[model samples]
Target: MIEIKRLKFSYGETPILNIDELLIPYGEDCLFLGNSGSGKTTLLHILAGLIKPMEGEVILAEENITNLKTHEMDDFRGRNIGLIFQKHHLVHALSVIENLLLAQYLGGLPKDLNRIYQALDDVNVLHRKKAKVYELSQGEAQRVSIARAMLNKPKIILADEPTSSLDDENCERVIELLQYQAEKYDATMVITTHDQRIKKRFENSITLR
Candidate 1:
């Protein structure tokens, strides 16, 4: 589970995020909807422990990570959270399997070839395991990203505008894959986006102004 209290973050003199209180229970999927500059991504970053809030408590599970040091935060995030981005940030020079292995390594997890293969297969990208990352199409690459996100068996999966550029079919595919896999792992799934097309897919939602 995750909880935020009186969260306030700013860039210079401008306040970018000011969440009062938010809680996400374990093993659930929640959509975060908002307009541009409404702090959706900022909130996701705080949840993932990527951005330290200027003042507030970001509690994951039962630990408050707001005061965790950079290195400690990195390790903690690697083990507890999976972050997926809209651009499908795969290493262009790495093979598909290598890309996944890299993610696991970064997360401080032991590599499991079988799990890797299974995740790739789930996304219908197993055949491309030996192919270079740059060789994949947008959808294919996004599938790989999903596979990598689940690689660490994280407690929470955080996605930022994942389906922003995807077509309807691919968008649905991505959403279903995240939801199903998160359920399988009992990981809370939180997706932050500006797209209204994704609103109807989930019942619980957090809307920011």
Candidate 2:
């Protein structure tokens, strides 16, 4: 489960986000809907421990991560949180398999080629395992990104505007893929987006303003 209590965030003196209390149950698929500048991405970053809230407590999977040191937060996030951004964020110079290997390395996970291959296969991109990220189509690259996020079988999946850049068909496909992987791992999935196309797809959503 994920919990946020008395959350408030600001940049310098400008406020960005605030929430009194929010709870997302374990294994639930949830959405945070908002417009641009609504602090949706800021909230995701806070949840992922990439940014610290000025005053708040964030608990993920029963662990209170807000008090963790920088390195500790990094380690926790690496192991328990899988993140997907609007951009694919893949290294163009590296092959798909190499990219996943790097993720495993950063996550402090042992090199597991079998797990990497299975993750790629889950996204239907196993055939492109040896291909450089730059050589793949937009959709293919996104699939590889999904595979990398699922490589660790994280307990929480956080996606920020993951489908904003895709066309209608690819957008639906990406959402399905994310949902499938989340269910496969029984992980809590949280997506933050302003895109209205996907609003109807999720049954539970919190709108931020």
Candidate 3:
């Protein structure tokens, strides 16, 4: 489960995000909706432990992450939090499979080729596993990114502006894929987006102004 209370964040003197209390149960899906400056990404980053909030507590999987040390938090995030960025950060110089290997290596997990292969197959991008990242099409690259995120079998998945650049059809497909993957792994999925196309798809949503 994920819970936040008395949450607040800022950039120097400018306040960015504030929340009194929010709770999301395990295996649930939620959407954070807002316009460009609504702090949606800020909230997601805080949840991912990428950025610290000035005040309040963030509890994930029943642990108070706000109190964790830097290295502890990094280890926790690597093992429990899966992140999907707005841009696919795959290295163009590396093959698709190599990128996933790097993810596992950085996470301090042993190299498991079978896990990588299953993840690729699940995302329907196994055919491109040996190809360079640049060789995959936009949609294919996104799938690879998704596979990488799920490679660790994270308990929580955080996605930032995943469908902002897609057309209607592709937008739906991407969201569905994310939801399916989250459900398959029984992970709590949180997506932050300004796109209205997916707003209705999520029953539990929070709007930030």
Top candidate (TM-score): 2
Stretches of candidate 3 exceeding 4 Å from the true structure: none
Q: What's the TM for model 1?
A: 0.96
lDDT minimum window of 10 residues, candidate 2: 10-19
For residues 1-209, what per-residue lDDT tens digits would candidate 1 score against the true structure?
88889999998999998878888899988899999899999989888888889898988877799988999999988888888999999998899999999988888889889989998988899999999988899999999999998887889889999999999998898898999889989998899999889899999987888
TM-score of candidate 2 on Cα atoms, chains taken together: 0.98
lDDT tens readout by residue for model 3, 89-184: 888889999999998987879999999999999999998899998899888998899999999999999999999888888889889999999999
Report clashes for each candidate as comma-separated counts: 0, 0, 0
- Candidate 1 backbone collisions, by pair: none
Cα lDDT tens digits for candidate 2, 12-89: 888889899999988899999999889999999999999888998999999999999999999998899999999999
Number of the candidate with higher TM-score, 1 or 3? 3
Candidate 1 structure lDDT? 0.90
Which sequence of candidate numbers ranks them by TM-score, best first? Answer: 2, 3, 1
Any runs in candidate 1 off by more than 4 Å, and if so which? Answer: none
Q: Report every candidate's CA lDDT.
A: 0.90, 0.94, 0.92
| RMSD over all Cα atoms, model 2 | 0.8
